[model samples]
Target chain A: SQTIHQWPATLVQPVGSPLSLECTVEGTSNPNLYWYRQAAGRGLQLLFYSVGIGQISSEVPQNLSASRPQDRQFILSSKKLLLSDSGFYLCAWNPSGRKTQYFGPGTRLLVL
Target chain B: AQSVSQHNHHVILSEAASLELGCNYSYGGTVNLFWYVQYPGQHLQLLLKYFSGDPLVKGIKGFEAEFIKSKFSFNLRKPSVQWSDTAEYFCAVSYGSTLGRLYFGRGTQLTVWP
Candidate 1:
């Protein structure tokens, strides 16, 4: 069985601070990874998706960026955080050419 | 560009009542549909999906959804919803051969009173 891990589960950061959220998937290789932000009342907004290592697609340009360093490791980062950047950030992964995606526990970031 | 629309933003129902959440998509091609449930303080889980074949797809926890191709809709239904069934339901659609990129709806929050 495959498992996805994300940390830290909750984060509190001041404005203009750097942000880094990690997501790793075990038991799967060459999986498609995605980063999404869920705001209050609003649905999920896809931020980035990676098909392979060093290949990232930005669904919506914003303050955040995503990277796939290793086959199973994905990272979401930001040089400076904004108040609007605060939300429930979720990471999801699925096998290549598959429609179903498995989501991680998610990171709740609060930018004060 | 593909887009999904879920009619109800929020719904309040008593236990044992029938539940129906409307979902529609705007895409003129072969597509895949999925329904995901997010329990309180938990991650998103797949309730059911429609790839092909059966128009009516049954999911876990006694939940089901019907896919109407002509209507471009996939509506989730539950004959008797339990209090544990209270959660947020999301409808997503993937078009053509893009299997990993899904367009999600605004989502419908279901609240069931015990």
Candidate 2:
């Protein structure tokens, strides 16, 4: 069975501070990874997706960026955080060419 | 662009009551539909999916959904609800045979009262 892990389940960051959220998947290789953010009581907004290592596609332009450093490791980072950057972030993985996705426990970020 | 719509924002039902949540999509070509459930403080889990063959598909926890192509709708159904079933349900769609990406609905928050 495959499992996705995310670090710092909840984070509190000061405005203008740098931020990084890491996601790693075990038991799968060359999986498609995605980053999504959900505002309070709202729908998910796709931030970025990667089909392979060092290949990332941005769905929307924002303060965040994503990187696939390894086949099973994905990282979401920001040089400087904004108040608007606060939200529930989710990381998901799907095997290549598969339609179904498995999600990791989300990271709740709060900027104060 | 493809989009998904979930009609109900929130629904409160009593335990043992029938459950039905409406989901609609706006895509002309072939598409794949899925229903995902997110328990409080948990990640999203696939409940059911409709690709081909039978229009009605059964999923975990006695949940089911029917895909009506002509109506452009895929509605989720559960014969009875339980307190443990309270969670947020999302409906998603992908264009054609390619998984490419998923367009998700706003989601429906279902609360089953004991």
Candidate 3:
């Protein structure tokens, strides 16, 4: 069975602060990873997706960026966060060529 | 670009009430459709998916959805919804060739009252 883990389940940060959210998947290799943000009462917005290591696609350009350091590790980072960046960030992974995506617990970030 | 639409933003029903959540998509090419349920404080879970074969797909928790190709609609249905079914439901669509890029709808929040 595969499991996805995300750190700092909840965080509170001041404006212009750096942001780093980690996501790791165990029991799968070469999986497709995705980063999404869900604002309150709004649909999810895809931020980034990676097909392989060092390959990242931005769905919507904003204050966030994504990186795939290892096959199973994906990180979402921002040099300086904005108030609009506050939302529930989610990390998802699925096997290559598979349509079913498995999501992690998610990180709730509040930029004050 | 593919786009999805979920008709109901919020719905309230009593336990044992039948559920029918409308989902529509706009894409000329072949596409895959999925329904995901997010329980309160939990990760999103796959409720059902439609790739091919049966137009009607049965998912976990007594939920099912029917795909109408001509109508470009995939509507979720449940015979009798329980109070535990209170959750947010999302409809997603993606091109068949690009499995990783999914376009999600605004989502329908279902509130099944006890």
Candidate 4:
């Protein structure tokens, strides 16, 4: 069974703060990892995706970046957060050859 | 570029009512379709997927979706709805060699009243 884990389940940060959200997968190796931001009525927006370690493809230009430091570990970071950066962050993964993706619990960030 | 379109943004239905959520994709090439459900306060879960073979795919919780290649539509259907079925449903399309790059439609929020 494969599972994805994301943390700080919920966070509240002031504007102009640094942000880092981590995602890790279990029971899978060399999986395709993705970062998405979900907003109410806006659906899930693709942020970044990685095929392997040190390889990240960003979908949209934003105040954030992603890194695949380890095979199953992905991190989303930002040097300075903006008020518009607050949303539900989701991490997902699928096997290398599959198109079906599984999502994590998600991190709700509130930038005040 | 591939894109998905969900016709309904919000739907209100009573218990025992029928459900038909429309989902359409713009890519005519080889594509994989999926429907995901997100219950209140829960993560997204796969409701069903269409890779090939049967055009009609059955999923858990008595939900099913039909893939119409000519129409480019994969609409979800349920015979009878329950109050517990209140959740947001998302339609996604994936094609080419983009790996996990799935184009998602703005989800349809289904609210069932008992």
Candidate 5:
């Protein structure tokens, strides 16, 4: 069975600080990876998606950015964090040519 | 703009009560619909999906949704509710033209009293 993992289940960062959230998938290769932010009432917003290594697509313009260093490893980063950047971040993966997505546990980042 | 809409923001019901959540979309062309559940401090889990064929599709945990193309609505239904059913539900849609993007609604918070 395939499983997705995310690091720093919870995070507390100061404003203007750098941030890094990692996501890795097991039992799958060349999968489509996505980054989403779940706000209080806005539901989940797609931030970035990657179909392959070094190929990332941004769905919305924001303070965050995403990268696919390895085939199954995805990273979400920010040079300087903002108060509005605080939210629940989720990483999801789906096989190529498939629409169903499997999500990770998520990282709750609180920017103070 | 093309988007997914969940009419109810929050719903509170008693145990054994029926469950009905409305989800509507305003996109043209072939689209895929999905319902996902998120418990407290948990990630979203797929509840059900509709692609083609039967209009009514059953999902895990006794949850079912019917897709009505004419109405552009995909409503979720459950005959009985349990306290464990207290969670947030999200509706998402993906158009055929958009290959790797999914449009999600604002989510409905379901609170079931025991």
Candidate 6:
């Protein structure tokens, strides 16, 4: 079975601080990875997606970025955090040949 | 560009009441539809999906959704909802030609009272 894992279930960061959130998938290779953010009971907003290592497509301009260094490892980072950056961040993956997306336990970020 | 829409923002129903949530998508080509549930304090889980063949798809916990191509709607239905069914439901769509990136709707929050 495929599973996705994300670290730091909850985070509190100060303004202008650096941030990094990691996501890793098990039982799958060359999967499509995505980053999404949900603001307090709102719909998900796509942040970034990667098809392969070093290849990324960002959906919106923001204070964050994403990277895929390994086949199943994805990272979301920000050089300087903003108060508006606090939200529920989700990481998801879809197997190479399927449309069903598997989601990981999200990271709740609180920027002060 | 493809987009998804869920009609209900919030619904309150008593236990054993019938439940239906509306979802619609706008896409020119073939698309795959999905419904996901997120219980309070939990991650999102797939409830059901529609790839092809049957217009009606059954999901876990006695939930089902019907896909109407002409209407561009995939409405979720349950004969009798339980109090435990209180959760937020999301509708998503992936264009057949896209790279499996799903476009999600605003979502509908369902609250079932005891």
Highest-DockQ candidate: 4
Error of 4 at B97 (Å): 2.1
| TM-score of every prediction relative to native | 0.97, 0.97, 0.98, 0.97, 0.98, 0.96
Residue lDDT tens for model 5, B1-114: 878999999999999999999999996689899999999988789999999899999999999999999999999999999999999999999887676578899999999999
User: Which CAPRI category fits model 6?
Assistant: medium
TM-score of model number 3: 0.98
Q: Candidate 1 falls in which docking quality class?
A: medium
lDDT, candidate 2, A1-112, per-residue tens: 8999999899999999999999999998999999989898777878899999999999999899999989999999999999999999999989999888888999999999
Query: At residue B87, what lDDT does model 3 achieve?
Result: 98
What clash count goes with each model?
0, 0, 0, 0, 0, 0
Candidate 3 residue-wise lDDT, B1-114, digit = tens: 678899999999999999999999997678788999999999999999998899999999999999999999999999999999999999998887885688889999999899
Tens digits of per-residue lDDT, candidate 6, A4-112, equal 9999999999999999999999998899999999997678888999989999999999899999989999999999999999999999998777899889999999999
Clashing residue pairs in candidate 1 (N, C-alpha, C atoms within 3 angstroms): none
Q: Name every residue pair that clashes in candidate 4.
A: none
Give DockQ: model 2: 0.66
Over B2-65, each residue of candidate 1 has an lDDT whose tens digit, in order, gives 7899999999999999999999999767888999999999989999999899899999999899
lDDT of 2 by residue, B1-114 (tens): 777899999999999999999999997788888999999988899999888899999999999999999999999999999999999999988877544588889999999999
After the best TM-score superposition of candidate 1, give how far the Cα of residue A101 lies from its true spot, in angstroms: 0.6
The parts of candidate 2 lying over 4 Å away from their true place are: B97-99
Residue B42 of model 5 has an lDDT of 82
A24-91 per-residue lDDT for model 1 (tens digits):
99998999999999998888888999999999999898898898989999999999999999999999
Error of 3 at A65 (Å): 0.9
lDDT of each candidate versus the true structure: 0.93, 0.92, 0.93, 0.94, 0.94, 0.93
Q: Which parts of model 6 are misplaced by more than 4 Å? A: none
Q: Provide the lDDT at B46 for model 4.
A: 95
Look at candidate 2 and tell me the lDDT of residue A96: 95
lDDT of 6 by residue, B15-90 (tens): 9999999998997579899999999998899999999999999999999999999999999999999999999999
- Give the better candidate number (3 or 6) by TM-score: 3
> What DockQ does candidate 5 have relative to the true complex?
0.76
